[model samples]
Target: MSPKNLNVVAVAYDRLSFFEFGIAVEVFGLPRPDINPWYRFATCTAESGPVGTLAGISLQIDRGLKTLDRAGTIIIPGWRNIDERPPERLLRALRRAHDRGARVMSLCSGAFVLAAAGLLDGRAATTHWRYAERLQRDYPDTQVDPKVLYIDGGSILTAAGSAAGIDLCLHLVRRDFGAEIANQVARRLVVPPHRDGGQAQFIDRPVTKCEDTRLTSLLQWLQAHLTAEHSVESMAERTSMSSRTFARRFREQTGTTPAKWLTFER
Candidate 1:
């Protein structure tokens, strides 16, 4: 990657979502001596004075929006509120950065910020399922896909939720470096090296405790045997259920057909 492209900036704000912000820090800010060259991460805030988080913690932000001027990648963590508009200056900075070939990403509700900046216009994006409807309603020009965990729309990316942000970050690592390096970074972070961007954000239905456990076990088994060919009938047999019942249950628990889920895992 070009040295300029290694510059990563994460935006902070009042009532910041700490988990999402930390995800950016974890993925891009942490020093990675193992890798030849790594992203240079920094935080900037649109607001002056100490920014307060929802957890009551106050963060002193030294860098301002100017930091984004040279950033090659900008990460917007979950915004303070989906309804509240971000500062116009911040949005303009994002536009300028993006216009200059920088990648802009949003985690969860932060997609709203990008939407407000007109960056998501006519682009496929996603956010937390809880906020998906509002995003679609408000930004009619953007394609809001609530089912997937993230959308890597070339220069623009959006993650579904806080946890999904990690998946997207690891994906960026894979793109900037390679599978081996990204895998090594994932190992250090103790997370899965890859989760397909198209994977469902969540299961569609609630299951009984026992059923949930069984489903988890089955999914784990499926992941462990991704290379093996297995039919729905075989999977149903393993769970002692009729194929029709198993298929329905599986779909309810995974929000996808068994074949599609298996393909994603592979």
Candidate 2:
């Protein structure tokens, strides 16, 4: 990749999502002297004055939206609010960057920002499951799959939530530098090297207190015996519930079927 294509710029805004922003910094901003020609990262902002975060902290960003002009990859962390539209200038910068062949990525609610800029239209994207429906509703042109961890639409990528952002970052590393280098980065971060973008999001769901307790115990047991061959019948028996009941309860508590959960775990 050209040195210009190694330049990564993350956007900061008022009421920043620190965790999501931190994901970008952790993946790309940190120096990796061992790797030749690693990414060059910087932070930029569309807003003037101090950029405050939800954690009651403020950021001092020296770079402005014009930084996007030189960015090869632009990261937009979770937006402050899904309902509020980003500044028109910021949107235009994104469009210009994309038009000039810059890769753009959004984490969690930041998908709203990309959508607002018309980058997600006619493309498949994802965001946090809680906001998936709203995103789909608000941006009818985009295909929103709430279940996936992320969507890699070539130049435009969107990650589901905070942790999913990490997965996406690792994926970008893998894409740019191959699995070996990405794995080294993941080891430094103490995270898995890869997670399929198609994996289901662990959506939150309400479960009865009793069922929650039982499922929690069962999950622990399954973790300890990951190599064991198991079936729904066996797992249901372990939980002292009928197979049908177990399947329903498992989906209720885990947002996935027992088989899919087991596959993901392994």
How displaced is residue 44 in candidate 1, in Å? 0.6
lDDT of 1 at 259: 89
Candidate 2 per-residue lDDT, tens place, 1-266, comes to: 32348999999999999999999999999988999889999999999999999888999998999999999999999999888999999999999999999999999999999999999999999999999999999999999999999999999999998899999999999988888999999999999889999998884433323357888898889989999999999999998999999999888878788888887777
Runs in model 1 lying further than 4 Å from the true structure = 1-4, 205-266
Given candidate 2, what's the lDDT at residue 63? 93
TM-score of each: 0.80, 0.82
The best candidate in terms of TM-score: 2
Task: Give a tens-digit lDDT track for model 1, residues 163-208.
Answer: 9999999998898888898899899999999999999998634322
| RMSD of candidate 2 to true structure, Å | 4.6
* Each prediction's whole-model lDDT (CA): 0.90, 0.92
Best by lDDT: 2
